[model samples]
Target: MVVLKMKTISLKVNGITKEITVEDNELLLNVLREKLGITSVKAACWRGECGLCTVLLDGIPVKSCMTLAVETDGKEVITAEGLYSDERAKKLMESFVKHGAMQCGFCTPAFVVTSHYVLTKNPEVDGEELKKELNGVICRCGTYYQIYEAVKDAEKYYKKETKS
Candidate 1:
């Protein structure tokens, strides 16, 4: 009989460097929530379709559940927590609040992360494009309308800031 052992890898998560031993098949989401205590990245569909596990890999959104821990070595992973401190994030949070975009909160973190990507990538996105981008994320709480409005509002807020 042969036995295979997991390998330890070092990764920079939310600007902090960490070295963790994980199974070869371990997903980044598990390692993040279980090992690193980054619970903001939800563990929902695990299949990558839900986008509930979205996290920023060097500033691009990637489904953490579908990403291998080993593959994240030497890469920077930013979760919803990282965005909480950002100025744009503050505006987004305010919009979500004003629009009542958050219901159960299970999907709020993912929504926020995805919206952050949308706003950062194209701050000029219209309401239609905002809906398209948000379509990638699923909110079982049925807060779609509010979510869309929040993203659109955040886009306007961010654009105004950049132009000022």
Candidate 2:
């Protein structure tokens, strides 16, 4: 009998370092939601077109569905929950709630992840450019207006140095 080889990957998720053993072909989305109990990284659109599976890989927005679990070795993988520890993210979440950005909450995590990156990286981005940056995610609730407002409102916090 042949044994399927499993690879052990060490990575930081939601500010916690975890070592998980997974099959060589497992997707990061599966690893996050199934093996790691990170349901915020949505499993929608397994084909990689949906932004519901978004996560921050070293502060850059990435689609967890397309990323391989083995590829995350030694990397920092942050989910929506991970953002809470950072002041900038907390403000953004507040803005999202204040603006009523999320309806179903299925795709909100991806928007939060993407918007956080854009805002923190460049606090002065205009509406058009900000829209471009957030164009990757698909929101079925048609809450783009509120989402954009949330990101825009959160820009004020990004202008300052956030506390860790």
Candidate 3:
């Protein structure tokens, strides 16, 4: 008989710290979406190809579907909901709406989070690099042009942070 081990882990999500027990082999995507009820972390293409479940792990973007819940213990995981207080993220979201970057909205959160990471790292990221960086996330709605425009429009907000 095989029994899965339950492990207790503490992870900070969207600035809130949560301590929960999870099966040893549970995926971080399940932990965030199922246990924590973070619906923004969508579950699609479980193999991590879709990037719909991307989350920031200690300020770096990672595919939660490919990450183990246990590995997030004591780490900070930021989803779209968590970026509310961030000016850059806020601007990016606004731009997304204004530019009509999302359609159907399933992949919006992941694009926002990943785009936030890209802009945070380099507000002046060029078109090719931006495309390469966002290649992981797939949008079936084919709003790539609009998404690009939104990110570009929000570049000023991200740049403002660097100057300050």
Structure candidate 2, residue pairs in collision = none
> On a 0 to 1 TM-score scale, where does candidate 1 land against the true structure?
0.91
Candidate with top TM-score is 3
Q: How far is candidate 3 from the true structure (C-alpha RMSD, Å)?
A: 1.0
Q: Which segments of model 2 are wrong by more than 4 Å?
A: 1-3, 162-164
> Who is ahead in TM-score, 1 or 3?
3
Ranking by lDDT: 3, 2, 1
**Candidate with the larger lDDT of 2 and 3:** 3
Per-residue error for 85 in candidate 2, Å, reads 0.8
Point out where model 3 deviates above 4 Å: 1-3
Which 10 consecutive residues of model 2 have the lowest summed lDDT?
Answer: 155-164
Candidate 1: 10-residue stretch with minimal lDDT:
153-162
Backbone clash pairs for candidate 3 read: none
Give me the overall lDDT of model 3: 0.93
- The regions of model 1 sitting more than 4 angstroms off are 1-3
